[model samples]
Target chain A: MADFSLFSRRFDVKRVPGFASVALGVFVMLYMPVILLVVYSFNKGTNLAFWEGFSLRWYVQAYHNEAVQEAAFRSLYLALIAATLATTAATMAALATTRTKKFRGQMLIYTLINQPLMVPEIVTAVALLIFFAMIKVATGHTGMIYLIVAHTAFCIPFAYLPIRARLESMDLTLETAAADLYASPWMTFRRVTLPLMWPGIVAGLMLAFVVSLDDVVITEFVKSAGQETLPTFMLGQLRRVVTPEVNAISTVLMAVSVIFVAMFFVLTGRKN
Target chain B: MIEIRNITKVFGAGEHAVTALQEINVNIAENEFFTLLGPSGCGKTTLLRLIAGFEHPSTGSMLLAGEDISLLPPNKRPVNTVFQNYALFPHMTVAGNIAFGLEMLGRPKAEVAETVDRMLRLVRMEELKNRQTSEISGGQQQRVALARALAPQPKVLLLDEPLSALDLKLRKEMQIELKRLQSETGITFVFVTHDQEEALTMSDRIAVMNAGRIHQIGSPRQIYDHPENRFVANFIGDSNFLNAKLGNIKDDQAELEFAAGRKVTVPLHRADLSDGEVSVLIRPEHVSIAEPTGNSHELTGVIENIVYFGTDTHYHLKLASGEAFMARLQNNPSEAEKRAAGDKVAVLMDAKAIQILRD
Candidate 1:
């Protein structure tokens, strides 16, 4: 039997106030670091060992740097291409795995798709370097194509989780009913299934883009001279000098990542 | 017209094989609102899915309006189904949902708009055309589902418990609406439900199914007035069983001697009994509380319990032979006028009310 009460049966002002204090305490503990980071990105300090007063010089300096600007653009371009490719592949994988019954060795194929995420990034970097070397020997080509390929492989698993989650959570009865209503497979997918999954697909694509934007290991191994991504360029700059400009760029990247994650929640989160 | 012949569906294979339907044969006439009524796991839904082409029969073929459609996919078939959940597109507006089937058929934009408007007005939802599906109530969604299914004007419309999601009052209203819609459209509406009252009220003909097979198929009155088997009789309505043994056999009537020294006459077929044991089934409403019977069926007993309903009262009677039977009184009576619990009484029943079940 159920009490079926909309409110709590036991009402106590003292207990309610005590619970509110505990919840507020948890919030401060979790968000204090993020509150500190944004406040100090504008600090006028040469060294990130401590934050000084706020100034516009670091922001101005970061904008004027040629190498940093070029690498940032390169990273943006690579992340865009890699995210598109990876999200497309992951979307297809999610559909085939969830909508259709298992084909031969489906488990093996799934494991292989998710392998780059599980295996050490260093191993993946080394493997891609070798594989690219073999391809170069056979066809004789040298380009940033290898770096893009490596980043896409690493981002696919991250992209796949959200799409697969969305697909599994979806009620497939609508799709079957759509089919019975004379919508072909392609039309049913476009009209009924895709609209329902748009939120998940966007989340997955953004996740893959952010992962590619932050990647360092694979790009370091695969890039030739003058082809370093933003992350690899940051690694080079950090080796020479650790400046507030690095903090400025890191702050910007972290902000972008936060924005994407926030958008993900807004798009996919249920009201309840 | 739809024809299903030797339709057998088996799931799994080898050692894991399970047969879900067994050589089902049925011919559903055009424009007939048929119902497949049974309990859960009775394969009624499976039969509907097979007709909708959601499932392929493992053994036999099906024909729709003289064309062999057995190998056709669901989208290619001339049928649409309103799923148990209604299956309304959650992302689309009501108008968009209804227009989906027409759009899929490559209809012109003008014609699709005209048809969708006609259907919206038909279901009386034209004002709510722009509303999201989540904003509407269940009964409204039921109408939307019906409008969507009928907008395409498929040869047959399949409804899998379309009204099961609503409360009792709404369910009754939707039942009447569904009947009217079917009659006006003149398309085959094959409904599947377990509720007997719903099946009896709306269906033109009812097929009583059990355990993956149809028990009987007849008009609603035929099914309610005369059920073919003991299971059908028990499933359809409330009936009281009186233990009896066969006394003698005659043409078109059999003599049954009840255990409590009462004899009842019933229609006799060769399958009625030769017999070792048998039972007589009479609906509770048909049994009378008064005792003016002569040679039809008469019994003396004590009223163990009295249940006074608004329209009728039920008397639970216990015989001297330790058998309990029930009789219904058409009118309500005061406690002082009615026989109290544990009071002795006599009851009578018509011979036409008795059905003999052979064992």
Candidate 2:
């Protein structure tokens, strides 16, 4: 038989020429700076550019600093509260958007929920600064509530995407079956819908936590005096003196983010 | 028992409105295996959904055992449905899926456990009761779905094409299994399927529907032997429709004149069949190929194509009147060896077996 083929016998798309080199170059450019920062966090000398012998002196110094300890604790506490609230709101919003029939202004509701991710971080930070300024003047109080609310608002879309995707992929007939078997709407959600999408919920929570913990621009603009989150505290330390201690803190934050992102992938990749 | 009266369901708004079921009225008896059979997009599934309370009628009333249930929610209605995809909970084990309904209904723990065990045994899945639903095969999932829906012991069980996903052999096995389960439990089973053979084999009464309207509802023999209209006759089984002229009608017998100057006195089935150009339905199995016998009831045709099935052979013939026809002959090696393509044969049909179809 003749070689009846529709495909061209030219360069293979699977194994493109010089593609491996380009990909290697991209990865090196992306990770080289972060790898250097991690390496300097354990350097014996205080200089960041020149690495002496490897030592844990900077880690010990960062550990002993009371301000760093306080800021780290506050960062964790804020992330926990904000992520919990954001995940709850996002789950409800996802259900409302996906489970019901489409209506007028449904697209508008989606746009508003994802507004934070679309707007520039600096713009949101400036808007929050002005809004919180008015609230502070009226209440005459300065508390962590303002920062928590701002973080929760910004983290909702980060939590919503995975959960909505999970719900959309789910078999809707399962819920209908539950109802047919005499389960109330709430009971059906609790037994079938909730457990089926539990992985997505957990992934959303982890993503929101990581995003809130890594935020710096909004924290820089929103925090009052003496209310320094870990990111803002690191910024202050960098301006006064650049040391391996700051690299140590950055390495720790990066480790936390990497762990969370890895877990998010594992959870969302799981098949139902 | 279920009674559906004047049920009409319309989806969407004015210009885009699509009528799914129109003026559907059915009264199902207790413990009867009723089937809604049709082609896809024909209101069979929609009517099943309406009975299961997934989709409410746009205008109608439904009563379950003398109680009005039209406005009741699905959770409040004493009904259960086995979905087409078997909608088993992926996270739960087979036993857990079976026990969910009893648990939701707040049965005692011991009773729920007892019912779950009985259901597992009924479906013969006791060995894999602890296995997750996703770990099982498609046929096993179908059994689990049946067990789960039957565990609740609802007043009515609605099955929406539950055997469609299985292979041919598995589908056949599940069809018999479903019939056995229905008979064992004595629950009113309302099954929905587009497969005519499946409906005929399992259902005590089948409602043949098309274009959101039910053409006929009767027993399997009634539907196959005497369909009220052309749609019902064509949908239930293989039928050859032929044009004929109706002559004088007296009592229940009418004179039907076919092509080639052939005429027969067949029993009239419809009162509205007037003496004019009309259509007649003849089942393939009712017609037989024979040697040319000079009888008025015989129509001569030349065999154009011959198809051999394992049990029967289909003879596609071109009649002398220039019309195509088909006749099924059971494979009998003693006499079947004599027939071949292009052989002139007489297509013999009984007068009582000929059904005059209403347009």
Candidate 3:
């Protein structure tokens, strides 16, 4: 038999009850809803709150729904285009801020790039809606372009932060040495700066993709008629009725977000 | 060859401005191993950077091989630099780093490879050619930096305290290695360092600077034996300064009077010795301790302490007027018991060994 005294000295049982209860409460509060939704998506019962038995009927229904399929494809397409555009703009902004000497209005430019993160999303959505409406009235055009523009604007800060941090932490002596070794300014950037900052760029792109993919409010406000992204489509379906098919669609979106975040971690984790 | 004329570098504007270099002028000869030696913040590295084209002089022109290249950027100038930190690209292998300069010059692929192999052999780093920069040791990194800088065949090379980060033994080894490389390549080298020993060991000529001003420029022997001012004398080696007054000036010598009515005749290197007040400088090794030898110019002092360094010993003495001075003596076994603390000894000074410094 193990000695009770040694075990008591090594392990503190007095605080276990309080700590364990707090942890359990947090876990249930955070993950319980998602876990319940996923479990009920397999329920044979049509009622979302009650499970009759295990089955894949909701999953099959979600796959066969033409409206859900179209919405998912649209969301993916918007995310890809917006993420690329945002990352490209963010790279230029990061380089301008970090690579050059401090100049007048530097602080103002930094604040402008990060304004979306500080201001409420609802305000941005309403503002973009009014601005796009005016443009449509002036030009008589309506398409997915308005939604893409709004999402890309919102994602710029997410991409800018990581790229700026990477550039700041880089050793400037390497670049100077490259110039001393007969490399032109453009060649130095192409050969030295790009290779070292690639990981940060990839991480930023992935973060923007995930953020744009999960957006709902901005999409709902900026998107024109008949341009319902997956989240907006899910919201519409929920208002009309409650079904496990909605849970199935949400599970797929969550999985894609998880994969993107994982890729970001792996890309930025390597030793330079 | 490089010529820097009337160079001044001010760091900032208005109240925050700082003068890093002021009206500096230097002419480094072709294939010369010259050095800019000073303490930190003395603008030695700034002067080197100006020559390397990394910085433009505020009010000066830099001529390279008789061509005005002051406005040319570093990439367009025929110069290379070995940064103090080695600055090896961590993403590249040793061979890739050494090949970078040649490749930037648009050399053919086969020529780049051959030059890379030659550089690897030059630094004795052929075995580590495929290793990443982070995987190499500091000394090895230094070798890679040197090879990388030399591979492009630049007309001039600038080294900014490249050996300061190395260990003592390795630094000593690299000092000789650097001298050998300079001679082998016959490239003009403008080395910067704060270590007096390193400058004395490796440089063919050195310019001593202080407070953004150059005090003297000469060969190692001239700089060590005969410094122009108190700064250079104190900076290069150990010296004892005695406050004195000039008594009379001859054609090639001068009479000086120290405190306690001590007078001595010293040779002058310059014809104009008319200054009334002067400071007499003598190296510690030049002073000797002996008994009264009927020499009127000799001064008596009491030994306060004896510091025994393995090859030599320093005797700290207090003179009659309470001024402290030091004399260095060889620590031979036969002379081991010659002097001790509290002993009275006469300090001997040779007329040729004394330097009269102008204030």
In terms of DockQ, which candidate is strongest?
2
> Model 1 misses residue B81 by how many Å?
1.4
State TM-scores per candidate.
Answer: 0.90, 0.95, 0.94
For model 1, residues A1-272, the per-residue Cα lDDT tens digits are 77756456567565765888988889999987666655666888875667788797777898898888999899999999999999999999889888997689989988987998789999988888888889988987788788788888888988888888888888889999789878999889998889888888999899999999998888888887799777888788889987778777877888888898788778667631
Instruction: Measure candidate 3: CA RMSD.
Output: 3.7
For residues B1-359, write the lDDT of model 2, one tens digit per residue. 89999999999979999999999999999999999999999999989888888888899999999999888889988898999999999989999999999999999999999999999999999999899998999999999999999998999999999999999999999989998999999999999999999999999999999999988989999999999889998888898888899989998888989864479998887777788888888899998878987765578989999999989989999988898899988987787568889899998878977898887
Candidate 1 root-mean-square deviation in Å: 3.6
A62-179, model 3: which lDDT tens digit per residue? 9999999999999999999999999999999999999999999999999999999999999999999999999999999998889889999999999998888888878999999999
lDDT of 1 by residue, B132-216 (tens): 9999998899999999999999999999988888999999888888988888889899999999999999998998888888888
CAPRI-style grade of the A/B interface in model 3: medium
Write candidate 2's Cα lDDT for A172-255 as tens digits.
999998999889999999999999888989999999999999999998899899889999999998789999999999999999
Mind listing the fnat for each candidate?
0.86, 0.95, 0.88
Cα lDDT over the full model 1? 0.85
Docking class of 2: high
> Candidate 1 has which clashing residue pairs, if any?
none
Chain A TM-score of each candidate structure, as shown: 0.84, 0.95, 0.91
TM-score of model number 2: 0.95
lDDT of each: 0.85, 0.92, 0.91
DockQ, 0 to 1 scale, candidate 1: 0.68
